[model samples]
Target: MCDECNQYFAKKIEKRVLEMPYFRDVRHRNFIESKKRRIPVSKGIIGGAVDLKKRKDFGTEVIVNSPDIFQKILNGEVKHMIIPVNDQPIEDNKLISRFIAKIAIESAAQTFSSKKGWNNFIINTPEFKELRYYARFGDKLDMWNYSQRRIYNETDRFLNPKVSDGPYEVLHEQNLVFLRDRELYFVLVLFGIEYVISITNPKIDGYKSWLIENNNKCPIIEKNERDTIKGERYF
Candidate 1:
C-alpha cells in the first residue's frame, strides 16, 4: 500500500467509521486502543455534560457535568447518581456496508495473494466486480444487504482477574466465515457488537439461517474450522 492510498483509506473511509456512535461509544466507554490517529469521543449527553478520559490508576473514567458534582460524589456529599440516556446510534447501512466490503475484500486478497496467480484471480473475478465497486464507491452501486446485532453491551464489565479492574471488555474480533456453496460472510465483532455481511451476495438470509442451525453462536469464537481460506482472513 502506497502512502497516498493508505492516507486516503484512513482519512476517507476508516475515519468516518470510527466517528460513528456505534464505534465512538464502544471505544470511549470501553477505552479500546486506537493508536495515534484515533479520535477520542470527548463530549457526551448523559442527560447532562460529561468528559471522557483515562483513569489515574487504570481503565476509563468520566468527569461529570461539573467538577463539583464529581467531587461531591467522591467526597460522599452526594449519595446517588443516575444517568438515563437514549443511547442507540443511528444505523448508517451504506457507510458500514462499504467498510465491510472493503475489509472483506482486502482480507481475502491478503490471504490468497501468496498463491501463484491468485491476485490476478481476485482482480479479474466477475463475481467480485460489483462488491469491489461498492467498497470503493458506495451508493453509486446498489446497496448490499447486511446483518448487525449486539451480542453484549458496550460498557459491559466482564470478569477479568488479570486487569486492574476485576472486569475487562472486548475491543474487536473478526473472522471470514467461508464455506462451500455458502455466501462468503465476514464477521466483525466490534466492542461486543457483531456485524456480518455476505461478500459473495447482497442477501443476509444465508447467515441468519446458518446461525439458527448453529444455535445462534457467533462465528468468531465458534469451534475453529480446519479450513479458513475458502475466501478471507489469515488463512
Candidate 2:
C-alpha cells in the first residue's frame, strides 16, 4: 500500500484465513483508491461498520476488508496495486464513501429507537434514500434505541419546525456527492442524551454558494464566527 493510502487504515489489524488451520498474522494490502475502476472482487461479503472517530489517530475509515479478499489473503493469493482517486489527498480523504457510510450508520443507530418511553423522541424522516444499496452488516445495527443515545450522547440539538440544521452541514461538501437533493442542507443534532431537530425543505443552491464563499466549511456557524459568515468555517 502507498504511504498515503496506508495513512487511512488501521494502524494494525489482526487477520487470519478462515480455512487456515493455524495461522494468525497481520494483514497488509492496498485499498482500491479509485472509485472509477471496477472493484475486482465480484462476490465480496460485507464485514462491519466501524467508528473512525474512535480510531481518528489512524486517519481513515475502519471497515473490515471484504470476505472474498480475506480468503485470498489466507491463500496468499492477493496482489497489491495502486489506483489513483485524485492528486489532492485532502479531497481523496474527504470523498471516501466509507466515511459517509459511517456517518449514516451512526445517525441511524442514534435516531431510530423502539423503546416505548422515548417514542416522542424519534426523528423518522429519511434522507439519502437512493444510497440504500449499501447496507451495514455485523452485530452493530444501523438503528438505535434511546438508551444507546444516552450512552453516546449523540443527538441533534435545536428541535423546531421553522429553524433547521442542514445536511450539507452534517455531511460536509466532500461527503455530499452521494446524497439525494432532499437530503442536502438538512441537519440533525446529537447533544447529551436528547436528539433535537427542526424540519426544513432542502436548499442546495443557497447552501452551495454559502459553502463556497466560506470555502465549503461547516454549515453551522460557531460562537466565535457567530458575527461573521467567514468565521473559521465550522468543520
Candidate 3:
C-alpha cells in the first residue's frame, strides 16, 4: 500500500467509525476503555426473528421501538427482539427477511473475526456458506444486484492480488465494499422484522444464556443511551 492509499483507507475507516450510532455512546466508550485496560467485558448477543402477531404486552421483556432496535443493539442490549415486519403483507417477505438476517449475521461475524485476528473464524464455515448463498441469491435463487456483485468482486481482488501492485487501492475498495454490504444487510434485517414475522415477543433469558455460553467466541456490548449532538440524536 502506498502512503497516499494508506492515508485514504485510514480516513475512510475513521469517518465510518465516527458515523456509527454508538460512536459517541457512553457504553461503547467504556467498552473501549475496558479493552485498553485489559479487563474482561461480558459479551451478549442480539438477534432478530420474524413474528406476525401484534400483542398488547411483551411480558417481563421490555418492548423497544422497532426503529430503535439497532441503536439498542449498539447500546449493548445483548438480547433484543423486533416484532412483525409491518402492517401489510408482501410477497416472499418471509424469505427476504431470513435472507437479510443471514447477511447481517454473516457480516457481523466477519467484522468480529477480522478484529479478533481470526482469519478463518466463521468465513469458511458451512453456516457462513449457507448465509452467503442467501445473500448472493434471492428467493428465486437468482444472482444479487450489481452492488452486491461489485462488493464480492472487490473482496476477491483485495484478498487475492495477481501482483503486488495497487495494494492500497485494493484495500480501500475492500473497505468500501464492506461498508456498503453492512448498510444493506441492516436495512434488510430491519425491514424483515418490521413486516414479516408472526411472533409477539422474544425469549430474553434464553438469549442471555446463549450469549454467556458464546461470550468467549462472540463478545457483546451493553446498551447505552445515544449521545446528543447539536440537539439531534445520531441516527
Candidate 4:
C-alpha cells in the first residue's frame, strides 16, 4: 500500500518479466501495450504444489464460507485478507499469476500473528445457514449432470475424506491445510492483481460489468470468433 512497497513490487515484477524467455523479443512491445492499454502483462499461474505444513495459520479456512468474514476483512477487523482474483487474467499470463500467488503467501505470513487477525471471525448463524443451503441445494439442476456429480464427489472426497469405518472428517482436521492454504493463496493473489489493474488502467471502461457478464468465459479466448486464435498464442 505504501509508495515504497508499490515501487518494490513493480520492480520485482519487471525483473521477472525481463528474465522470461519470451520477453527478449516482445519486451518493448509488451511494455508499450501494457502502459498504453493499462493491461498487466502476466506470465500465468505458478504450477506445482505448495507445502502448507510450514505455513502460519491464516485463520480457519471455513471462515470464508461466512460472508461476514469478508465484511470484517473490508472493515480492517481482520488484518490479513484474501481477495478473489478474476479467472480471466490468470488464464492470460503466467508471470502475473505467479507474482500474485507469491504475494498472497507472503502477506499471510506478514500478518499471521497480528493482534487484530482472526479474532473477529466469529460465525454468523444465519449466514452459515444460507451458505449451507446454497452449497447443498442451490444448484439442483446442475447436480443431476453426470460430470457435475463426479466433480462434486471428488470435491467431497477432498473436503470430507473417510477415516477407517468412521464418518468423514473435515479436511483441516485431517491436516490437509495445504488445500486451504492454496485456496487462500489464489484468492489473495487475484485480489492483488485486480487492485493493480484498477490503479494502472483507471481509464478502461466497463471492467466491472465485463467481469460480471463474462465470469464463466475464458479471457484469453474469444468465443464465437472462428478466425480468432485462443489463449496466449493470440498475443
Candidate 5:
C-alpha cells in the first residue's frame, strides 16, 4: 500500500479493531502488546464491568473507572463489578470485513511474491476489486459479512510434547483454505476466537458449507490437500 493508504488503514481500521472490546480483552489475556508495548484494558459491559491492570512490579491493580464506584466499594456498598468477558458474538461487521479484506489481499500478495506475475494478478484481478476498494477506500460497500465463532476458550492451552514448556497458549494463528467451490477463505484466530472471510467475494457461505460437510470441524487445523478440492492454497 502507498503511504497515504497505509496511514488510513492504521488509523481508521486497525486501531478500531485493536481497541474493540473483544479484541482488546483478548490481547490482554494473551499478553499481546501493542506497537507501543502496552496491553489494552477491557471495556465490555454486557454483564457490567470493572477496571483492573496487571503490574510487573506487584500484583493486579484495580484501576478505577469511576470515583463513585470506588467510594461505594470502600463503604462496603458495592455488590459486584463483573470484569468484561465475552463480547457479542459479532460486532462491527463492516469495519471488520474491511480489516479482513485488507489483510487477506496483503497476505495473498506476500504469498504470491515469489510466484512470478501472481502479485500483479492479485492487483489486477476483478475478483478482488470489491475487497480492495472496500478495504482501502471504505465506501465501496456498506457491509461485508464474515463468519465468526469461538473454537476454544480465550485462555485455553494446547500441549506440544516436543516443546519443553508443555502446554502453551496460542496468541494468534492464521491460514488460507480452499474449498470445493474454488473459493479461498482466510481464517484468523485471535485468542481462540476464529474469524473467517471469503477472499474471492464478500460472502462466507463457502466456509459455512465446508463446516457443515466436515461435521463442524475447526478450519484452522491443517487439512490434507485431498481434504480440499484440488487444494493449492492451504499453505
Candidate 6:
C-alpha cells in the first residue's frame, strides 16, 4: 500500500478513539492507556527529533526516543514500521519534543499535507538546535524513482502523445533487495539505522534483451558491500 493508505487507516482508528467522551477524562493518562481501556498492541508511544535541510536539495534525519520500539519491530512485533533512515543522536532539548509530538499527532491524525507542513513546523520550533549534517540517502532513492518515472512517461508520451495517460499509466516494477537479518541486527544495534537499496526499473530499448539487460542493472547497489567491517557504501 502507498503512504496515503497507511495514513487514512490510521486516521479512521484515531477518529473512533476521539469520539469517546472518556478520552478527555483521561487527559493526564499515562503513555499507552485511557480511562476507557488499555491501548491496543498495534499502537505505542513514539517520540523523536528530526532535522531537515534543503541546501541545494532536501534531506531529513530523525533520532527517535523509542529505539526499543525498533527492537520490537526487528523481533516481528511491529509490521508497518516507518523508522527514519538516519541514525543521529537525540538532542538534549525538551522543547523540540513538542515539535515531534506534533508530527506524530499529524501522522496519526492523517491530516492532508501533514508531512510537508510538519517539516516546517519542526524547523521553526523554538528549541531547534544547530542544524546537524543532513542525510540524503532517502532523497537519493526518491530521486531515482522520479528519474524512472520521467523515463517511463516520456516514453509513453513519445508512443502516444495525443492524450495524457495520467500518473498511474506508467508501469513500475517491484524491485526487492535481499539483506541478511543478522547483519542488519548488528548495524541497528550500533547505529539505530541501516541502509537499504532503493530499487528501480530501468526501461531499456527492445523487448527480451531489454528485460535481461535491465534485470542485470536492477540492483544499482550490490549486497554485502556495506557491512560494518567494510567501508559501507550506501545503495
- Best TM-score goes to which candidate? 5
RMSD of 4: 26.3
Residue runs of model 1 more than 4 Å from their true location after superposition: 1-4, 37-39, 42-47, 59-89, 152-170, 223-235
Q: Show where candidate 4 strays beyond 4 Å.
A: 28-98, 102-235
Candidate 5 minimal-lDDT segment of 10 residues? 226-235
TM-score of 3: 0.24
Model 3's lDDT to the true fold?
Answer: 0.31
Sliding window of 10 residues with minimal summed lDDT for model 3 = 191-200
Ordered by lDDT, highest first, the candidates read 5, 1, 3, 4, 2, 6
Give the count of colliding residue pairs in each prediction. Answer: 0, 15, 22, 10, 0, 0
Q: Count backbone clashes in candidate 1.
A: 0
The CA lDDT of each predicted structure is: 0.66, 0.27, 0.31, 0.30, 0.70, 0.27
Give a tens-digit lDDT track for model 4, residues 69-119.
556656777664332222223233434433433343344344443655432
TM-score, each model? 0.70, 0.25, 0.24, 0.22, 0.83, 0.15
Cα lDDT tens digits, model 2, 1-235, are 2464334332211111111111100001112222333211211122222112112133333344567655665576754422212111122121222333334434544444455633333223343332222222211233211111121111122322333542111211112212233433223222221111112221234444444576544443343432212212111
lDDT of model 4 at residue 51?
15
List where candidate 3 sits over 4 angstroms from the true fold: 1-95, 113-119, 138-235
Candidate 1 residue-wise lDDT, 71-144, digit = tens:
66677776644433324445547878888888878877877889999878777887577777777777577778
**What does candidate 5 score on TM?**
0.83
Candidate 2 stretches greater than 4 Å from native: 1-95, 112-128, 135-207, 213-217, 225-235
The alpha-carbon deviation from the true structure for residue 228 of candidate 3, after best TM-score superposition, in angstroms, is 12
lDDT for 205 in candidate 3 is 34
Order of all candidates by TM-score, from best down to worst?
Answer: 5, 1, 2, 3, 4, 6
Model 5, total clashes: 0
Candidate with the larger TM-score of 1 and 4: 1
| Tens digits of lDDT, candidate 3, 1-235 | 2476346434543333333332222222223333234212222224542222222242223333455655766777645443221112233433334433344544456556656645464456554455454443434453222211111111122212344433322222111121211221222212111211111111123333433575422111113211112221211
